[model samples]
Structures are given as C-alpha cells and as structure tokens.
Target: MLKDVPRSTSFGHSSSVGTMELIRPRASKSNAIRIRRSGFQDFRRVGRRENDPRYYRFTLKRSGRIDISVQNREFGGFLGFPTPTLKVRLERSNGKVLNRRTVRGGEFGFISRRLDRNTTYYIRISSSGESVPYRLGLRTRGGAELFR
Candidate 1:
C-alpha cells in the first residue's frame, strides 16, 4: 500500500544544483510542509559529477520486510570523485528519531538498513534538505517498476 507521509513542506533558497528537497504526501493540505532550502554554493568538490537513478518512497504502517539501498556512479576516476556524499535519515511524527546515517560518498551499494513497517516515516536527504533542483526517487520492492 502507498500513502503520503508528511503533512506539508517548503524549500528555502537554492544557491546551486545541489538540490535540497523534502519528501511527503500532498493529501495533507490541511497543514503546510516545513523545509530549509538554504546554504548552497558552487564550491566545486574534487570528485566529478555522476548520474544516478532516483528514488521514490511510500510511507504506510505495516509489519513486513523492508530494506534501503543506494548506488554510486564513477567515471574513470575523473576529478578524483570515486564516490558521492549522502545523508539518510528516518523520523516519525512529533519529531522522534528512529534512525539516522550518513553516506560519505559511494556509488552503488545496499543500505543494509531495515525499516519498521508499523510506524510513521519521513525521509530527508542530507545533501539538499528539501531544496530545489535536488533529485529523489525509489523503486518497487520487486525492482520491476520505478516511482517518483
């Protein structure tokens, strides 16, 4: 089953392509989403930029097996960027943190993290916190279809 998670959110200032975005459901128009789209700059990291698939997520209360994974891309070691920096976090309503992790640059890899099915969830990307131009997507558990 799929359902919108957050009540509402907003994006702040966007300084670069380092997009910052917040994920949630639109059904909760009763309330506005909260976000911080600020503090972005074109510092030009040493590693080169690579294209990666996006992720889409669904938040519903359930009790089944769940896993999170990420894939990193590399380009002939160009700009010495063999990996990409990432931040993954999970939270519940009332601002309770169930899990939080930082992915410090990598291409393709499994998150090896299992999520609790019977809980409210809100995922926030570390790179761009609900900012514009950022990308977020997910694949079905069977890996057959894509959703964003």
Candidate 2:
C-alpha cells in the first residue's frame, strides 16, 4: 500500500519529491550543508509561523491501525543538545481526535484503530511557543511506511 502525504506548498510546487528540514535560522547554514550532503531532494523551513502548528496530512491506504512516530532532529545530533517536549495530536479529517500526547527523550508511537481506508488523518506537531525541527513517520499494520 502506498501512503499519500500532502506536501507543503511553501516549497513553491504542488508536487515535488523531497525531504523537509524544519530548522532554526541560526542552524540553517550548517543544516543546509548536511541536508545537501545527505542527498535529500529539497529542504523547507517550517516553524516560521509563531502560532500556526505544522500539519502533515496523509491517507492510510489499508484499514486497520497506523503506528505513528516522531523524531526531533535538532534535539539529538552531533551536538547532543537537550531534547524538547514535543506534542503530537492525531485526528481525523472531520476534527475527531484519535490520540494526543507529549513526547520527549524517546521515540513516541501511537496506534490508531478502526480507521477507514483512503480516509485522511492528520498529525499535528508543535512545541510550546517554540520552533522545533522534527521528522514524522507512519507505518500501517500491513507494512506500508511513510516517512518525512
């Protein structure tokens, strides 16, 4: 099953295959080099809008449950900076919530069950009045994986 994640239009294209790197302005210079050396197609800076939380919307191809995972790239790198508390909210397209919790220091996972196949679900990620760079991934029970 192929997962469909709605790409950000902030990159100026509707359909471009690339990885997103949401980093702070101070870290931008080095992060850009790292991202380029890593061979990611492109990198877009999120966490710009102060009040607006970044939303990654994706549709699960099969019915069952999806395992969601989030990682903070800035918190843990060669510098070993302290990790920030990240909040993740999983909700359906209709505003119905599936799960909401705070994660820190470790990988966070949640299983959303009884979802309709091809229906869109949203993963809302934000920090408390701070900009955080993160990577979110999803995997269904049937073995489909979606990463960003």
Candidate 3:
C-alpha cells in the first residue's frame, strides 16, 4: 500500500509517499523540519492559526498505509539541490541507531515491519548529503506519550 500525507491544506501538490516499509522522510529548510501535525492540541479554535513551528508527526498503526505530504511547507535542500533525499534511522531509547536506510525521491515503504506500539522512536533526515534530526519536543510519538 502507498501512503500520501499532505500537511493541512497548503498545496495539493506537496506530498510525500511511502510504501509498506514506511521510510518516507522529507525535510525543508525553507519550511523548517517538522512532524506535520503530530502534536496534541486540546484547544484549536477558528481564531487560532497553525503558525507555531511544528514537526512532522507520522502515526502508523498495526496495518495501514501512511502518507507523508510536505504541503504548506517547502521541501528541504531547496537551496540548490536538484534531487532530494531522506535518511531514516530508528534510534533506541538509549540513543542507539538501528535500521538505517537511504530513501530516494522523498518516499519510502514498509513491507513486513511495522512500528512497535508505544515504543520510543527517533528519526533523522538528510538531503543532498546534509543531515538533520526531527524536532526536539515532538520527536516522541504514541507509545512514548503513554509511557510519559
């Protein structure tokens, strides 16, 4: 299955794709690296606008397709990169890197492996040989939240 997640409603064209492996990561220095609505907001009214710097939040379930769209945000390496890349690594809670892979075309897929429920996950993205980590606060998702 293929997943395409567009940030809010910026540009219908801006989107990231991932296969069953789910290794899709896109960073845009132009738009600031983010988790894309992966935060818990209890109060978001019409008057409230999503202007605060956000991170790219990917929520993967037991079985489903996850789409990562870079909408409303610009793709990283926009400075002078012709083709962009996304590097992903799963870091353990103790700060160990595991399952490292290079993903081209800003899209990735996951076949047999799915994210461990309520486990701490760390991700990094690099394009054009440049490296960047996910936002500091929003790095931990789901399981990490429950543990906290």
Q: Score every model by TM-score.
A: 0.38, 0.52, 0.31
Give the top-scoring candidate (TM-score).
Answer: 2
Query: Lowest lDDT 10-mer window, candidate 3?
Result: 40-49
- Candidate lDDT (C-alpha), each: 0.35, 0.54, 0.34
Instruction: Give per-residue CA lDDT, model 2, range 11-97, as digits (tens).
Output: 687875566544323322112221111112221223444323656666645556566666645445337666556677877778788
Give candidate 3's whole-model lDDT. Answer: 0.34
Clashes of each: 26, 0, 31
Clashing pairs in 2: none
Native-to-model Cα distance after best TM-score fit, residue 21 in candidate 1, in Å: 18
Off by over 4 Å in 3: 1-82, 109-119, 129-148
Q: Please provide, for model 3 over 1-148, each residue's C-alpha lDDT reduced to its tens digit, 9 standing for 90 to 100.
A: 3444435336756555532434333332234332333332221111012222222233333322222222111235466664444444445445576555555443442211335543444443333343322222232233332222
Off by over 4 Å in 1: 1-57, 73-84, 109-118, 128-148
TM-score of 3: 0.31
